[model samples]
Target chain A: MDNIEKLKLTCLHDLHVALGAKMSPFAGYDMPIEYAAGIIGEHNAVRNACGVFDVSHMGEIGITGEDAEFFVNRIFTNDVTNAPDGQCFYGMMLNDEGGVVDDLLVYKRGHNDYLFVVNASNITKDEQWILRQADGYRLCLEFMSEEMSELALQGPEAERVLEEVVGIPGADLAFYTFKEIDRDGDTVIVSRTGYTGEDGFEIYGSHPFIRQVWQALMESGRATPCGLGCRDTLRFEVGLPLYGNELADDITPLEAGLGIFVKLDKPDLVGGEPLRRHKSEGGPRRKLVGLEIQDRAIARHGCEVLSPDGEVIGKVTTGYRGISTDRSICMALIDARYAKTGTGLSVKVRKKTFPAVVVPKKFYKKSYKA
Target chain B: MIRYSKTHEYIRVEGQKGYIGISDYAQKQLGNVVYVDMPDMGDELEKGEDFGAIESVKAASDLIAPVSGEVVEVNVALTENPRLVNVDPMANWIIAVDIADMGDLDDLMNQEEYDIYCLSESH
Candidate 1:
């Protein structure tokens, strides 16, 4: 018997292949890394104009019941208690030891109704973890990952594209909020949220509806068909955290430099006690910090970070030659003593070690129209 | 005459010196070259040794030497614009090296043989 696990395909897989995109395996899916114009072209298109991404591989779960809001607040670090409908909260689901299970966005669709958007690679693990936590809650959990498809129309021109090209009015929606629209017979959810740190919208619907929207956007010629290669770069330029790199099963949200999302004032949560204690005890032993390398060599994930005296202090989580900022930068988890801004450090890139300095994590300023 | 290595590097022989660069297939595989790290002049390179690195937007790749040689000149053009390799890998040789041993050429594949080798490796 062939034991090789088959990779999953999203609704836009055929279209991506037709466009001559460089395809690679990502999170168990055969996804596009970039197209003929390459990563730089696609990246510039998003920064200056607009780009559309097939983010359908992202997992979605629906929770509806009398205790839906209460249950979500218990598992999530952000305090979403009594949040207005259509509002979205970005936070993490933590384990008992305060490590991250996953970072996700929770949408309060209505009273007693919620939706969760999670990382594509963590679909099975997130489902099992959420189900285990749902043992006592009076809520109905529905796994809609396979049935749903998503598209992110991002950049400065996203609103105009949505209104004129896709025939959807998205200017009325506030940042981090969403609205459900009835298109013909299918209900499509459109949110003014994105990971690219731009003014954009995330549209969710059935596979057919998503394919139709993708085709229409591509035909319009205003939105560039971007792939995951530029998507990672765009997010990295603005200092966003990727799950497996920045946050992991053993990396806590506080340690990942995302303490702002973990609401400490709320009632007890799944990992609340430990997180609160960790905070009260003067923060984590190791912290994530940004490093600016003096040389042009790109520091990548798993590269060792060393102190000025040559001690192995930490490891790089993510790094790149910032397309927008035009500098070699990276984020690393290192000892608290070496994480202070302006501290001297160095990174081992293959055969040589390059000098670096601790800097602010936000490499590029975000241009979100909030 | 030109020769290729299994690792996708190529050498175009001229007298006792040869111009070296990655193969066209290798450049296409490594999308969007952003930077190239090359060795200084007079540095010695052994057969199948990593002489430098080539980085793209997503990842980096090592540039392996197909034959033992001494670095005569580093392509300074690549330092300013590395994408020249992606545009034309043959014309934009990465380095010029003095051949240390003529027998090293016997181990490399010629154009026709290398073409067939690349086809077989792709599958």
Candidate 2:
């Protein structure tokens, strides 16, 4: 039996099916996993040329009011106070125990207005958590998930596609910055940001406006219509953490090797104390590291990571036959003792144990616009 | 005679030898097969047990054995280019097994029955 009752539909659902996309249930939404070009073709297109993804399934929450900055800083790990309007900061919201509640992109749209872009799967959890933290803070919460749609235009040729084909002229925006512009009488938020390790932009707008943009990009025949399949590969190659895989409710940013995003020096964040302690004392038991398998077989998620002596150290968080780098690599959360570079490790893939070595988590270098 | 299992594995028997692979419907559902993990030629495969895995870009699914047998030959071409499975799943059989129990064929569905079974499953 099909489990379509609880599953939501994205705005591009009909369009995806029209283009012969392989639809699958992801994060409670019937989303496109790939198009007719397939994952490999779509993945290579984003690395070499331009590709667009209907990331409308992602959740958006807006926080507005006087205490927006202070209140957000109290819950979020990144130092967003120093960031000016139009600046986007990537960080996590953590629980009191230093475990990640969710990792999100915080966009400061105005002095009192902030937009939080979070993973689709964590929408309800994140909203509830934020509502709980909004008790004493002077803020108004607006869940903009259903009303908004997002498109990620990524690759080396993304800027050209956006400027000429999509007709959104915010290509001049610096990386990690965004601006609201009038597009055919509709206000659209265009951010010079992406998850694919390539130079790209993320456009957030109303469903109608997003639909128009999607159609234009599709009709231009330049931007490949990518799916969540290639999106995972692209992000994994660049070592970006997917919430469920890398940053779970029990996993802290420190353990996930995202310490730079955790602004512990700032006083009184929800999970600050525990994260600070971890930073100061090296308290995290496990650390995230990259492992290169010596064999052709991929070491998939949940595979056991072991020491040469046969002791289970950790497990693989994410793995791929990296489309960009062309290597069978995986990021594993292993014991801190064996997380160093060049450390000998092995991953038990099904029956046979394959030899591996600890390498840097960044399997492919990012080509983000400076 | 070719028989299809409820698990989507198909076995084509030629005397004592049987060539095994996932059904075309199963391959289409998998989409853009990237890797096909198979047991070695000498590995024993029990009925209804997972022999290996097939990986697509989005996920990996275990390939189950429809009948008890010992792996006699594996399709080596799939190791170099796994996309062959997606191109033609029937032509790109995963392994050839020496049938341990000829009676196990009765447990599977024939072409006509399997077609009806797949039609019901889709709905």
Model 2, docking class: medium
In angstroms, the error of model 1 at A91 is 0.6
| Candidate 1 per-residue lDDT over residues A229-317, each given as its tens digit | 99999998888999999999899998998999998777768988888898889989899999999988889999999999999999999
| Model 1 DockQ vs. reference | 0.74
lDDT of each: 0.92, 0.91
Question: Which stretches of candidate 2 lie above 4 Å from their native place?
Answer: none
- Please, what are the lDDT tens digits per residue for candidate 1 over residues B24-58? 99998898888898999999999988999999999
Residue A268 C-alpha lDDT in model 1: 65
Residue A338's lDDT within candidate 1 is 94
TM-score of each: 0.97, 0.96
User: Using lDDT as the measure, which candidate wins?
Assistant: 1
lDDT of 2 by residue, A116-150 (tens): 99999999999999999999888999999999999
TM-score of the first chain of model 1: 0.98
DockQ of each: 0.74, 0.58
